[model samples]
Target chain A: MWDFIVERRSQLLINGFNHVYLVFLAVVFATIIAVAIAILVTRLPKLEPVANAVSAIGLTIPSFALIGLLIPVSKIGDGTAIIAVTFYAVLPILRNAVVGLQGVSPTLLESAKGMGMSEFTSLYKVRIPMAWPVILAGIRVSTQMSMGIAAIAAYVLGPGLGTFIFTGLTGYGGANAFNNVFVATVAIIVLALILDLLLIILGRLTISKGIRVA
Target chain B: MADVATAPNAQADARERTGRKRGPKLDAEQLIELFGIPLIVVVGFVAFAIWRNTATLDSVETNALPWNSIWIQLREHVVLTAVGAMITVVIAVPLGIALTRPGLKRAAPVVVGVANAGQAAPAIGLIVLLAIWFGFGFWTAIVALVLYAVLPVLRNTIVGLQAVDPTLVEAGRGIGMSNLMVLRRIELPLALPVIMSGVRTALVLLVGTAALATFINGGGLGGLLNTGITLFRFPVIVAAAVLIALLALLIEWLGQVLELVFRPKGI
Candidate 1:
C-alpha cells in the first residue's frame, strides 16, 4: 500500500488540482453572474419574479443534461464542463443573494436613501455588507455542490479528479485499479473538506460579528 | 443586520397599521407569471430537442437505439436511487431528530459537518471507492447514492422538526402523550412538508447523480449517455438527456401534487 501510494502520488496530486481548478472557476464565475442578476432584479421589482423563475428552472435541469446540451454547441472538453458546472452553481448563489438582500430591513434601505446615498453605494456599502452572512451561506452550499458535480465532469472527458474515477471504472480487473480509485477518492474527499473549511472560515471573516453569532 | 437596525422603526409602523386590513391575497395571475414563464422556456427547449432528434428517426431503426438496453440500465438506476434514498431517509431522519434534541445542540454541528463532508465528496470519487471496496456494481452505486443524498434529507428534516412549535410539543406532553407518541402523531406530521421538500430535492439530485453509475459499470441513463458519446450518436444522447430532465420535472410535479393533497387544512 505504501509503495502504491508513493507511485501514484503525482497522479493523485494532478487529479486533485484538476478538480480544484474546475470547481473554483465554475464557482467564481457563477458567483459573479448570480450577484449581477441579484442586483438587477432587486433594483427593478418587476423583474424579480422573472429572475427568480429563471433561477428555479435552471435548478431543475439536471447537471448531465446541461453538460450534454452544451456538447452540441461547445464540444466536449473542459470548456463545456465549466459551462455546465457554472450553470448548475448559479441558482443557489442567485437565490442566496436575493434572499440575503431581501432579508435586509426596508427601514435601513429607506434611511440610506434618505441620507442621499446613491443606489449603488447603498447596495455595496449597506445591503451587501448586511447580507454577507446569507450570501456566504449560499456560497457554502454552492461550493460543496459544485465540487461534487465538477468531479463527475471527468466522464465527459473534462479534465479533473474524475479522471482517476473513470480510469478506475475502465481499468476494473487490473491490480492497480482499486488503488488508483482509493487514492483518488481520498484526495477528492480531502479537497472537499479543505474547501468547506475554507468557505466556513471566509464566511466567518466576511460576515458581521452579530450575524456570525446568530 | 439591517433588521436589527430597523426593528424600532418597523415596530412603530406595525402599531400604526394594526387597525388596517391586510392586503388582498397573493394574486393568481402574478403567481402564474412567476412560475409559468420559466416552465414555458424549459418546455420549449425540450420540444426543440425532441424535434431535432425526431427528424433523424427515419434513418435509425427503433431497435438500434438501445431501447432494450434502457430497461436493463433503468433497473439499475432506479434500484440504486430508491435504495440509496431509503437508506438516506433512515439514517438522516433519526439523526435529524437526535440533533434537535435539547442535549444535542453542541453535537448537531458535528453531525451536520460530517454530512456536509459527505456532500462535498464527489459522487464519482465515492462511487469509485465503494467499487474498489465492495467490488463494483449494484451495492456500490447504492452506497454512493446514499451518501450523496443524505445531507439534504438530514438537513431539511432537522430544520423542519426544529421549526415545529415548542408549545405544541409541550401541549402534547401535557395531554399525557409519551415522547414517542408525540413525535409520531404530532411532530412528524407537522414537519412533513419541509421534510418532504428535502426528500424531493434529494430525489431530483439522486436522479441526476445516478447517471454517474455508468462510470462504475452500474448502469442507468448514464449508459445511454456513455454509449452515445462513444458511438457519436447525438440522438441517443439527446434522448437520454431529455428523458432524465422529464423524469425530474415529472417527479417534482408529483411531489407538488402530494403536497397539495396532504397539506394540513388552514396552513
Candidate 2:
C-alpha cells in the first residue's frame, strides 16, 4: 500500500479530488431540490405521502442500473454519474428535509404570523433556521450515500477513485492489483471521514447555539 | 447518527403511506397524484423502446438474449442478498443488544461510530477492498454486503431495545425472572418491530448493493446490465433494471408482511 501510494501519489490526489467533487456536486443538487420540495410539501400536507413514496421507490433503483439507463442519454463520465447519484442522494435528504420542516411547530409559525410576519418571512426566518440541524443531517446522509454511489459510477467512466478499483479488478492476480485497490479503498474511507468531520464543523459554525442545544 | 435513526422512521412513513387499512375511497386528485408519475415513466420507457428498435434489437431473436444466463445471474443476486442479510442479522442484533446493556452503555458511541463508518465509506470501495483481500467470489461479495448493510440493523436494534419500556422489564424481574428471561420474554418482544424494520432496510439495501458484485467477478443481475452496456443493447439494460427493481420491491413487500406477522397484538 505504501509503495503504491508513493508511486501513484499524483494520480491518487487527482482522483481523490474528483471523487470529492462529484459527491459535493451531487449533495448540493440533492439538498437544494430536496429542501425546495420539502418546503412545497409542507404547504400541501396531502402531497407528503406522494413525495415520500416517490423518493422511497427511487431508492429501489440500483445504482448500476440507473447509471446504465443514463449512459445513452448522459453519455457516461461525470454528467451521467452525477445525475444518477444526485437522484439517489435526493431520497434521504428529501425525506429528512420533509420530516424536519414538518417537525417545526405550527404554533411557532402562527406566532410569527401573529407578529405580522409574512408567510415567506416566517418560513425564511423561523421554520428554516429551526429546521437547520435536521436539514444539515439530511445533507450529511446525502453526502455519505453519494460518496458510495460515486464510486460505482466508474462503470460509466466517471471521474473518481473508482478508476483504481476497476483497473485493479481488471488486473486481478497481477502484482499491483491488490495494492491499487487497497490504496483506493483507503483513500475513499479517508475522504468519507474527512467529509463527515467537515460537516460536523459546518454544523457548528452555521447552526445557532439555541438549536444546537435543543 | 441521525441517518440511522431515520431509517426506522422512514420505514414507518412508508407503512403509514401505503398501509392505510380501511381508508376512504381515493378521490380523483389523490388518484392522479399517486399514479401519475409512474404512468409517465412507463409510457416514456415504452416510447423510447419503440423509437430505439435498431436492427440489432430486431435481428437479435428472443433466444439470443440468453434468458437462462440472466436467471442464473438473478439467482446469484438473491443468494447475495440472503446471505448478506442473514449474516448481518446474526451479528448486528446481538452486538446491538449487548451495547444497550448496562455494562456496555459507555461503549455505545464508539461501537456505533465504527458501525457508522462502515456505512459512511463507499460501499463499492468496501467490495473492492474485500475482493482484493479475500480474492473475488461469493464470500467476498457477501462479506462486503454484510459490512455495508450492518449499520442500520445495529443502530435500529440499539434504538429499539433502548426504547423498550423500563417498567415492563422491572415487572418481569419482579416475577422472579432472571436477566436473560426478562430480556427474552419482555425486551426482545417489544423491540422486535424496530429491529425488524432495520432488517427490512438492510435486506433492501443488500439487494441493491449486490449489483456491484458483478464488478468483483461475482455473477448477478448486474452482469446483464454490464453486458448490455458493453454490447450497446438498450433492451437488455432496461430488462435487467426492471428485474432488479421488481426484485427490490418484492423483498420490501415481503419485509412488510413479516412485520405485520410479527407485530405484537395492537399498538
Candidate 3:
C-alpha cells in the first residue's frame, strides 16, 4: 500500500487539485449569482417567489442527473462538472441570502432609508453586514455538499479525487485498488475539513460582531 | 345594517393603522404560479428524454427502457437504504436525546464533530473501505449510507426535541406522567415535524448517493447510468437520469404528504 501511494502520489495530487478547483470555482460563481438574484428579488415583490421557487427546484434535482443531462448539451469533463456543481451550489446560497436579508430588522432597514441611503448602499452597509453569519452558514453547507457531489462527477470523466475512487472500483481485483480507495477517502475527508475550517475562519473575520452575538 | 357599517369602518381603520392587513398566510394561486411552471418544464424535459430513448428501449427487447432490470436494481437500492435510514434514525435519535442531557452538553460538540467527519467522508470511499472489510455487496452499502445519513438525523432530532417547550414537559410531569410517558406522549409529538423534515432531507440524500452503489456492481439506477456510459448510449443515459430525477421528486412529494397526514392538529 505504501508503495502504491508513492507510485500514484502525482496522479492523486493532480486529481485532488482538480476536485478542489471545480468546487471552489463553482462556489465562488454561485455565491455571486445567488447574492445578486437575492438582492434583485428583494426589490421586486412579484419576482421574489419566482426566484425562490427556481432555487428550490434546482435543489431538488439530483446532482448526478444534472451532470448527466448537461453531458450532451455541453462537452463532458471539467466544464460540465463545474456547471452542474454551480447549479447545485446556487440554491443554498440564494435561499440563505434571501432568508438572511429578510431576517434583518425592518426598523433598521427603515432607518437606513430614512437617512437617505441608496438601496445598494443600505444593502452593502447594513443588510449584508447584519445577515453575514447566516449567509456564511449557507455557504458552508453548500461547500461541503458540492465537494462530495464533485467527486461523483468522475463518472462523466471530470477530473478530481473521484478518479481514484472510480479507478479503484473499476480495478476492484487489482492489488492496489484498496489503497487507491483508502487514499481517496482520506483525501476527500481532509479536503472537506480544511474547506469547512477555512469558511469558519472567513465567517469569523467578515461577519459583524453584532451578527455573531445573535 | 348599523352593526355591519360600524364593523366595516373598524376594519378599515385597523388596516390603515397597520401597514399590512391580515389575510391568508400563503396565496395558493401565487404558489402555483411560482412553482408550477418550473415543475412542468422539468417534467416535460423528463418525458422528452424518455421518448427520445425509445429506440434504445427497443434494442434491449425489454422496452429498450430496461424496466425489469431497473426495478430489480431500484428494489435492491431501496431495501438497503430503507434499512440504513431506519438504523440511522434509531441510533441517531437516541444519541441525539442523550447528547442534550446536562451532563453530556460538554461532549456533544466533539461527538457531533466526529459525525460531521462521517458526513465529510466520501460515500464511494466509505463504501470501498466497508467492502474491503465486509466483502462487498448490500451490507457494505448499508453501512456507508448509514454513516452518510446519521449526522443530519441526529442533529435534527436533538434540535427538534430541545426546541420543545420545557414548561410543557413540566406540566406533563405535574399531571403525574412518568419520564418515559412524558417523552413518548408530549416531546415526540411536538418534535415530530422537525424530526420528519430531517428524515426527509436524509431520505433524498440517501436516494441520490445510493446511485453510487453501481460502483460496487450492487445494481440500481446507477447500473443504468454505468451501462449508458459504457455503451455510449445517450438515450439510455437520459432514461436513467429521468427515472432517478422522477424517483427523487416522488419521494419528496410522498414525504410532504406524510408530514401533512401526521402533523398534529392545530399545530
- Pick the DockQ winner: 2
Evaluated against the true structure, the overall lDDT of model 2 is 0.75
Per-residue CA lDDT of candidate 3, range B14-119, in tens?
1111111113243432355345744765776667556755544555433445556777876876776578779988988898878877789777778866765666
Candidate order, DockQ descending: 2, 1, 3
CA deviation > 4 Å runs, candidate 3: A209-214, B1-64, B98-107
- How do the candidates rank by lDDT, highest first? 2, 3, 1
Top candidate when judged by lDDT against the true structure: 2
Across all candidates, the chain A TM-score values are 0.93, 0.97, 0.94
Badly placed stretches (over 4 Å) of model 1 are: A208-214, B1-54, B57-87, B94-110
Model 1 docking tier (incorrect/acceptable/medium/high)? acceptable
Report the number of the highest-TM-score candidate. 2
lDDT of each: 0.69, 0.75, 0.70
Model 3 TM-score, 2 decimals: 0.85
Pick by DockQ: 1 or 2, better one = 2
User: Of 1 and 3, which scores higher on lDDT?
Assistant: 3
Q: Is the docking of candidate 2 incorrect, acceptable, medium or high quality?
A: acceptable
Give the residue spans of candidate 2 off by over 4 A: B1-64, B101-106
Provide the lowest-lDDT 10-residue window in model 1 chain A. A48-57
